[model samples]
Target: MIYLAARAITTVFLLVGAAMADRTGEGGATIGSLSMRWDGQWYWVVATAGYPADLPLDATGHVTQNAWAFMPLYPVVARALSFLLGGQYPIAAIVVSLIAGYVACLALYHLLHARIDRVAALWAVALFAAGPLAALFQMGYAESLFLMWLFLALLALVRRRFGWLYLLIPLMGFTRPGVLAFALLLALYGIVRWRHRASDPLPARQIVHIVALGLLAVVVGFSWQWIAGIVTGDAGAYMKTELSWRRSWIGDDGGFVPFDGFVQASAIWFRVWGLPEPLGYVALALLVVAGAALLLFEPHVRRLGVEVRLWCASYALYLLLVFFPQSSIFRLLLPLAPLYGALALPRHPAWRWSMLGVGLALQWWWIDQMLVLGTTFTQIP
Candidate 1:
């Protein structure tokens, strides 16, 4: 019920934002159109046109932004759903996101309930459902669907249900670009279980399952690159397509370099805002330190259990390594939803309600900036 209400409230915000955008002469300002904005349009292209065998190139002979950067699962599912809706891909895409978002909420609640009290879990769901990026719940983005798979995968991991992961990991890997983090989590989890074997039982069968699952995740994570390479006859096709987006901001920083995105982004962003470049590096270091401390030392975060903490750590490291911090950073951080359980730990009504209120306010701000009035490159959601 709480989750439903939160979605309803976010829907109202989206509708109002759409109406406002319509008045401001924004192109394709209807609710359906707004839902399909930004990356939503890319997914639409993927669903309708399908990925090209030949990569699109610019005058400079560089890979231009194309559908290959997007994974196939969400749009493919939306395309199937569209057939049932008389070929209404937009409506089908939104429906897929809405349903997936609700299921993700349920999975999250259950995941948190096992580690914290029922009330805290509910509060966490409330916050997650009405979060600043909650708009993704109704939009035609793949995020909600990806989150659904991710939450369920985490639930399965927490309960020692390794068999479910055999199915979920592939779904997760195809749905989004974060399954490698899950692979890392499995490796860390196996080590932790091995170290605690004296007190907690670590069976040989479970060890085999963990090792196999880890290997599967790695294979699935890199499978898309191989698939793209095979189809395009260029092993670097997927990597080049992804780097094309970074080029728009950083102007072709050469080949893909792990962990260099953040460094380059930090300096670039700070310089854009009229700040010293050195401070950006210093700030990046501080941010990394702060994140590590929160995962290792924070008491409330500890209560969410090792699996959740490991996931948070793993996903954060993944982002630091591959992702360039930009406007979409908030959207990318949605996988860290489990950490909301820690924020909900404070039992004060004032604190909880205030958080919800602030979340809704930020949701409106995010929608207005990224969806309603945004027209420039920096406003990419």
Candidate 2:
């Protein structure tokens, strides 16, 4: 236990130390995020003041609320920290993000310790601490907030904390839409477990608990949509926006989108280099070729084990569903870095570590590029 604690503390310190070391311009000067990147500017404005409905809209004529701009949790935490720190909102924002990033590392340690072996868990936490995702956490954006909540939700899940899961699930939606999948999965799991185990050796109260858990997860999972509807005066409006955003980019009339379906659409997503002509079909064929190579033997990655395969497969699908290319897919996949390590086949521990080495190099490139994060897409400007 002491060893685990010590390892976790050291890993957290490393992540925080690295983050603190990078919180500024050259010459060790502390630079506020106000003029840094796109999301950084949005968050800086939010810290100075709450979002107003009359903020300037983009050329698309969207209502331009900070609601669609940044997630709420980090900004809320930053506001409190700013108030207490003599109104230095920028410092407070950086401090909050670094602290949240550190906490997430600790949570990841525990999350791993619960499932995998202790050594593997420690290694996973260390890898994550120094991973490309770590760079995002160091920025003023809400990636740290999303990751911390995600780790917390996972920790709660591993402990079978159904009630806490219910609470966390709703907050997860408020964090980023990626979490809704987790909530829905949890809800379905509860239902399936209850339905299939009705004749098992559990008491009536246990059955009631299962039913309640399932119902809570379902309600909480969808709660964000309902709230957004009330806020926007239209049920599923936000959902439609999210879907429409994808539809416009990948729908039938979308130039690059092939008729093969979402899979084809996904294949074409990463190849758009702001080309005017439709390159979707061309992109789709290229992806099919690359994907087939990865599956076959070029990368030599194996498709064995459900946990191993699903991690990469599901993540690829998730990316396709979200379809973006501001940063490399490798950097965006940093949040789930631990899972990728889990998915590596042929047991090349050295190769995996080397890959992580590559990831750190990539992270540094992004940090230097200053294209840390945002929903608008990132490319350090």
Candidate 3:
């Protein structure tokens, strides 16, 4: 009920934003079009036209952005639903996202309920449903779907149900690009279980399952690259396609380097704004330390249990290793939605209401900036 009401409120915000954009001649008059903006359009292209056999290149023969950057599952599901909706991909995509968002909420609630009081768990769901990125629930993006799978996978891991992950991991891998974090989570989880074997029995069967699931995650994580390579006849097609976007932001710095994107991005962003590059490095180091301390020492976060903290650490490490901090960084952090439980630990009505108000305010600000007034390159959402 909270989730549905939150979506209803978000719908009102989107409608108002669309109207405002239309008034400004920014071209977001209709809800359908608003939902299909930004990367939503890319997903539509992937669904309708399919991936290119040959990589599209610019005048200098550098690979430009194309369908290869997007995963196939969400668009494919949307395409199938479009057929039942008389070929309306926008409506179909939104429906898929909405349903997935609802399921994600339920999965999140259960995931939290296992570790916290019922009221805190419910409050976490409310906050998540009305988060700054709540617009994602109704948009034509795959985040909600990926999040649904991710939450359920985490639930399975929490319950020590290894069988369900065989199916969920592949779904998560195809739904989005972050399943490598899940692979890392499995490794960290195994270590924790092994260390506590005296209290928590890590039987031989469970160890085999853990090893197998970890191997499965790694395979599925890189499976898209292999598939793209086979189809495009370029072994580096997927990586190159991903790098194209990063290059657009920070220029072609030769080849892809793990863990270098943030270092480069911090310097570039600070230099662009006329700040000292060393300050950016200092700020980045502080951010990393703060994040680590939050997971390791914060009381509310500690109450969320070891598994949740491990997942947070795993995903953070994965992002540090591969992701380039940019406008999309907030969206990428959606996978850490489980952490909302920590935020919801405050039982005071004042804090809860204040946070909700702030979340809605930020949601409106984000929608206005990214959807209404997004005419330039820097406004990419």
Candidate 4:
């Protein structure tokens, strides 16, 4: 409890400090104001008012932004909490995220300790707590809620508690689109255990149960789109709304392409450097693929356990394929808890401390840019 409190309190201070700086420089703003500034604003609107019945469209008939693109679980909880708190959605959402962040750290620490030594586990928690974009913990974003549930789900998986999946998996899907990685990880884990049946301790019947649960988890993970589609009376409502986030930025009316972010980034770099654009794209593609392969197959990563390895691999691939390489990608990757395991590996004391120092520095840097200087539309937290 003390450890968890420390992590939570420290995160709160970092965020508050950054908010103070923003207020001082931007003619004053409350911490609550800072909390609901960006995506939190969207959640606040959705929670209080609910999503529109139609996919919002611009004058040009292009799909405009809609809250339906965001997941429902966080907003639903925030709405309930706000009702109890006299209808203060921002405060309610921040409160939910703050509490969830602390609990997530606690569960994450225990999860890591189950696989590594206490010292290493502690180090992993430190790294995560002070990581770049860690300030997201204090925001009204769903990251904390989603991560807490995700860590608890992972803990349940490590303990072979299939019952938790029924609740946790669905909540995860309702929290973030990234839940697909968890669904895939569970399926892959079942497959691995089946292939190594002699080494697997679970009974054959339990194996079947696990596989069945994994399939259900996948269905639940993807159920939100269908749910949204039904509500909006448009089968493609979810996709159209989500694609609106990038359609104008990438100018890609073409269908989804694998590694689309890489292609856009490569073109941007080429414009800056005067290099052949395709050459840049090819180079970035090779580097990303190589780096992913290294992390997936690295001995240190493998030691994090088969399930963690698979989750990291699937989540990393999902990011590469779907997400653009923007500042927000750092925040999006925070749920990849297995990366902490790899970071916790035994290393020189100086090396470990140095990495911690660098992480702290970057955390503050991110807080300043995304929270303090970002009160305007200059940066996305």
Candidate 5:
């Protein structure tokens, strides 16, 4: 009942937010138009126009953004659904996202309920709904689709259905490249369990089956890169295209920095707080380390089960590694919904209610900044 009520209320919030966002400077306002922004536009292009035979490049020989960077599954699904909606790809994509988002919510609720108390489970659902990028769940984006497969992967782990993981790997991979992080976490867990000879009811033959399935998961999770290589005839086609956007971000000193988001945040601290840059960076890094330690050592997180804890920990690291802080990180970090188990921890009633209030305000702030304040799609997440 809590899940159903939360789902209905979230749906209402999203539709109302979409309508408000739609009423921009332009006279025409539609849900599809509001939904199909930023990455949604690229997915829509792929669904309607398909990938380019040749990688598009600029005069400087840098790869220009193109459809090759996006995974194929969402667009493929959107294309098929378009037929039902008179070939309106944008509308079709929004429909797919809304349905997927609700289903993902259900999966999350079930997974939480099985592990945590009903109150915590309900709070986790509510936390996921009130998150800053919760609005993205309503948009024509793959976040919710990827999340559906992700929570299913969690459910599979809880059930100890190791073989089901193999299927979810590719399904999740084609939905979002972040599945690689998930595959790695699973493989690591399997390896540790095998080494410890953990209490398992499975026979030796089933152990072998589990190992083989893990290998397949890792391979299939990386299949998108191989497919891009085949299509563009460049071994690094996907990474190159995906990283092309970083050219603008990397500044004059060109190279990837691990935990670049932290570095960026440090810079923000220096500018905003007038702290010494070195001091600011160290302070930010320490804060991050402290937060990570709390999550890892917290009794609440440990109680969420080993698999869920490991998955959340691995994904948080993945975000630190690849996701430079931007408006997009709001959506990127939505995959960390499992960690909302923290919200389930016993806290003062005022503290819990205050956190939810803050989250909802931030959600509105993000939506308004992106939809109403920003002039271009590039400015929005």
Candidate 6:
């Protein structure tokens, strides 16, 4: 445990620290103070300055595309932590992002070590710590914190403490509506498991509990939308705004068009974004195929219990909803962090080499462009 903890902290410090400094600034903590690429800068700014609700966006308003506003949970956390940290939101945001990232790694170490071989577990986690997605963990975004919540919930499920999963799943719903699927999936899993073991008399308590959870997902997933609608009264507006965050998935004819349209749009997500051409898409396609393969072939997976399925399923569902086979190849596949240790970690030398090579090359490239230089500020006006 001690060695795992040390390796976990050391890996994050080396990887995330360097990349954050590169993207935010050479000044280490100063990089995330300004918005860089996507949702990060806005989270940090709103945390410190407070939420801005006006149109066309005020200096303080973190702009949205259509319906995709900043999910409130992380920024709200940023705000509270910023207040606690003497009003230094930048430092606060950095602190939260870094701490959450390490905590997630530590949890990964603990969770994976139990399932995978010791050495493979260590390397698997190290793979995640230094993987391409590690860059996102450093930004003032919720991915790391969101991941922590996810792993914790699934870890509880593994222990067969259904109560914990029930509680935690709703919290995930509050953070990202996408997470609501976890609750729904768990209910489906519960239903299927019960039906398969027909003679094993269903546990009344568990059935009621699981159904209650499914209901909760319905509320929490849309509560944010309900609130937003009451305030803005623009049903499609918010949905349109959210599309900007996922244009890679917005589709060719502006929706989930039929076969031809989907093929064209998916082609754009891959070709225009260089997702598949870069080999990343190949990895994602492989993972998706692997998941489909699981549902098709694995019969005992359900009997092995909900923890194994739910944790793995949550990430698989996340990928499917986003559905951009190219960009997601493996770069943003960090949600698989828990699975790093769950499988028999890269046993074959050939497999290990491929995984390591792809992981390292892609990770290095992500960091190279993520950093920001501050020289423009000091130049003569």
User: By lDDT, who's the top model here?
Assistant: 1
Better of 1 and 6 by TM-score: 1
**Per-model C-alpha lDDT, please?**
0.94, 0.54, 0.92, 0.77, 0.74, 0.57
- For model 3 the local lDDT of residue 41 reads 97
Candidate 3: global Cα-lDDT? 0.92
Ranking by lDDT: 1, 3, 4, 5, 6, 2
Indicate the residue-level lDDT of 64 in model 1: 92
lDDT of 6 by residue, 1-381 (tens): 432443444344445645666555465443343223345666655555544353243254433443236567777777788888888766666567677777777777666655655777666666676665665555666777777777776666555567786677666765554666566666766767687767755578877766776677667777766666655665444554554444434432363322332234454556656566445445556856888667446643433244556646765675566443433244345565665553325467677657756765665555444433222311100
Identify the runs in model 3 with alpha carbons over 4 angstroms from their true place: none
Superposed Cα deviation of residue 255, candidate 4 (Å): 3.3
Report residue 110 deviation for candidate 6 (angstroms).
Answer: 4.0
lDDT of 4 at 157: 85
Per-residue lDDT for 67-101 in model 1, tens only? 88999999999999999999999999999999999
Better of 3 and 5 by lDDT: 3
What TM-score would you give candidate 2 relative to the actual structure? 0.67
Which of the two candidates, 3 or 5, achieves a greater TM-score against the reference?
3
Per-residue lDDT of 187-265 in model 4, one digit per residue for the tens? 7788788788777666976777677777877788668788888998987788778777776466546656677776786
Would you estimate the TM-scores of all the predictions? Answer: 0.99, 0.67, 0.98, 0.90, 0.87, 0.72
Tens-digit per-residue lDDT, 1-381, candidate 5: 543454455456656656675565554555556667678889988888888878888887777778887888998998899899898888788778777877888888888887888777767777786666777776788988999999988888788777787788789988887876786677767765776675755468657756776677678767878888897798777766776765565533344567775687567647656777788778867967886786679888777877787787788777777665655766777888887776765666776677777777787777667754556634657
Which sections of candidate 2 miss by over 4 Å? 1-36, 54-66, 191-229, 232-332, 340-349, 370-381
lDDT (Cα, 0-100) at 302 in candidate 4: 69
